[model samples]
Target chain A: MEKSAGSVGKVVVDNISKSYDVGRLKEPVLDRCCLTLPAGQLTVLIGPSGCGKSTLINILAGYEKPDSGSITIDGAPVGGPSSDRLVVFQETALFPWMTTFENIVYGPTVQRERLRDEIEKDAAGLLETVGLREFRNKYPSQLSGGMQRRAELARAMINQPRLMLLDEPFRGLDAMTRELMQEYFLRLYEDKGQTSLFVTSEIDEAIFLADTLLLMSARPGRVIKSMPITLPRPRVPSMLTSTEYLRYKEEALDILHEEALKAFEGGSQAAADFVEAYEERETVG
Target chain B: MSLGATSTNAASNKSIPGQQVGEDWLYRAQRALTTPMPYLGIAGIAMFILFWYLTTEYFKLPRFVKLPGPVEVWTEFTNPDPIYGTSMYTFDYYKHIAWSSLRVMLAFALATGLGVPLGLYMGWKKKFKDYVFPIIEVLRPIPVLAWVPLAILMMPGREAPIIFLAFLAAFFATTLNAMLGVESIDESYFRASQCLGSTPWNVFKRVVVPGALPDIFTGLQIGVGVAWFSLVAAEMVSGEHGLGFLIWDSYVLSQYPVIVIAMVTLGLVGYVYSLLIRIVGRSLMRWTQKGQA
Candidate 1:
């Protein structure tokens, strides 16, 4: 595919905002969020549980639209879902009707007709790389959970898209299996190094996979902090206890904890202060 | 994306050698335990026949005395050109069966051809659904009998109206089931297809049709049953020769045994038609089996 080795998977978000009409009132979810995901590196979005992280990823994947602002992927403006941008859903979305081999080649087969044999060969190799060559013909129903996630990764990766959006792709696996998947994914990423936006609520996972981590605020979500991880390439779980990992984790946890508290408290003190100030100003006038 | 043979995605059809195979007696025992339905069914029928005989032939109780006994119907069915005659011969029985089967098949095929597309399109395209839904909702609830007069007036001939009635009976179930089938598909499949670069038409072909198949087959099975119900209704009203017509004509002639025979024939054929639909449904959807019983 001759993808440029560096600085090409860049994503720029310009003051994107979004809200949902949660029945009675429109609830603001993302408030004027701006982010620049540097090209050819892994960018992780992490936040409190209710921070509308999926909403942000959905917008970036072009499956959703923000209320305001814009997203550009590698200098091209993003719009509704295109092959250039793909999303890995939180729940496994591999078609159960399809075999591992069929699913991996689905994107390529459906997108274009020429070069089918070439794509088939690529799919076979991808299955091998992901350690699923033995399970290629099996239906998704037959594959173990971890194997299904790996097959999903192979399916997405085969497209060679400029930007990949993963929303909690490994959230449900056991801790051991999750770690293995992260490494398996990491190995694949190192080879391709495509620009990716990986969303997770877990701090350690973010630090392990991220080149740059964007810490998002709770409700009315937006980027509150950006931490650059300077860990050397080909990361490992052992880095979790290391001093450098601890420092980054501490800073992120601090910001995330503050946001979580603000959300939990409903920011009532600030609201109370505003009401009191309004009454005083009216009385003085 | 040019990957080579060295990294093969060769579909492994491997089963754990010893783990996959259970002992033969285990399967034999399972079969023995589970296949009791046929025997149970035969026992139930025999008991019902016994009750019928005891009440009608031996005891000669109330209304049972007036009703034809199992022996009388059995003898009449076995008779060659016997007295209780709709048509006088055994070949005439075959004729009635052929005619009714032909009618049911024609009406069922027509209903499936028309209804499945309408249902799928209604589910797929929202605007089309909005336009068509009011009429379907209003018309679907009206019983098939209610359509008989309009069908008789609107269709060209007796056969056409009769077929129309049969089609009407089957159409709603077929259409509604197919639509529900499409709706039942997980939204994730649609999203995945979009991410994989499927055109809307391609999505319909690959995802929508296959995903909705289980429901469509269900609709067909129900549709065939409904067709049988309407076919008889139409036949009683206007049919020249069918099982339903035979039942009515035998009643007029006071041939009670012939009427019973005609009723039984209808019941048996209706069952086999539905069974045929189920067999086809299972064969077509082998992918959905997951090898489960």
Candidate 2:
């Protein structure tokens, strides 16, 4: 795995703000949220629920446009979807009608401006890389959730995007499957060396997957902390058990914990009730 | 082998379900025979036929009131002209059956060809839906028979009403099904296609059509059934050479056997058409049984 001590490339986020129309009124989701995703490195965005981590990803993916700020990919203004940037959603976005092989090959086949034989070879190689070569003919529903994620990974990779945005890709997987998928993703990133921006709630996942972790605060979300992970390349699960990993995890957790408490106190009935119940139990103890 | 070992093997074999090799024709035959309705139906039909033969042949009732037995109907099927007399235009029962089947096939094809694409487009793109769906909704609830007067007024000839009625029967059911099929398709599939750089046309052709096919086929089966029903009603009014017309003409002349024959023909044609539609649907959606992606 290639290790770069300094920044790889520049991702400029210039005063981006977003608001959603909840019924008739506009509810502010992100207020001038400014953060850079270093190119050629994995950047993990962490925040409390409804903190606009997903909204940021959507803006980056060209699915949504921010009201004020602009996102530039390598100095070009991000306008809309292009082959240069890709997104892997938490849900398995595989086409139900297509087989695993077909789903993987779809990108190349549609972009048939490329040579057909070359596209086929690339898809086959990707299937092998994802350990799904044997089940290439199988449909998405036949595969386990982890395997489906692998297919989604293969489909996203087939396009060979410069920037890949993942929105909690392994959030719903069982613990064992989640670890397996994380390792798979690590290997993929190492092999492909593509810049990725991963949005996740799990502090450990952020620590493990990111070269830099961008922690954002609650609604009207803005980047509160940007912690550079000085962890070495090709970091394994065993590295997660290290003191450095634990320390980084604790730091991230501390930031997230503060945001969680703030969110709980700030007039959210469900959150307030939860915090009150917990405090009551603590006082009794 | 040891006695315990032998017993254990026997028990295991008993616990395991038996797998049949090749086609189990005997099992299928047994299942067919054991079906509750067919046995009861056969018994009821036999009793009816016996009563008809006894009452008509033995009682010697008035000729108009007392119809011929099943044997007479079968003989009329073999040599229809003498039994049905000159009033019935067709030489045999098979001729009328063939004519009705042909009309149904043509009408069904026309209805499906027109309805499927219109339904797909209406269901898929929201912009087109506002314009197209309202029109379909207005036209759909109106009965096929209700269209008869308008069809007669608008159409230049007799052929038009028959075809119009057949189209009416098929169009609404097929359109409804097609729209529903498209509506029910997993949206993620379309989104995935878009992400893969699929053009709108490719998405419709590859993703939308196939995803909606199971529902489309269901609509087609229903549409064909409705088409046959409409054909019968249409034929009664405007048909010159169909089973419906044959029934009407025979009833006018009081040739009861010919009327019964025409009724049987209509039922048989409807049954056969439905079976064909089902077979086609099953084959088309064979992959669905396996599972979704």
Pairs that clash in candidate 2: A141-B293
Stretches of model 2 off by over 4 angstroms after superposition: A1-10, A267-285, B1-82, B85-91, B291-293
> By DockQ, who's the top model here?
1
Residue pair clashes in candidate 1? A29-A221
Number of the top lDDT candidate: 1
Candidate 2 local lDDT, B1-293, one digit each (tens): 12222232344346445663123435544544355348779899789878877777666567724776677777766663565562244555567777788888888898899999888898898899898888888888888889899999988888877987898889888887888889998776676677667778877877778778888888998998889888988999887888888888888888888887778777767876776676666544534546521
Model 2 chain B poorest 10 in a row by lDDT: B1-10
TM-score of 2: 0.83
Q: For candidate 1, what is the TM-score? A: 0.88
Candidate 1: lDDT of A203?
Answer: 75
Root-mean-square deviation of candidate 2: 9.3
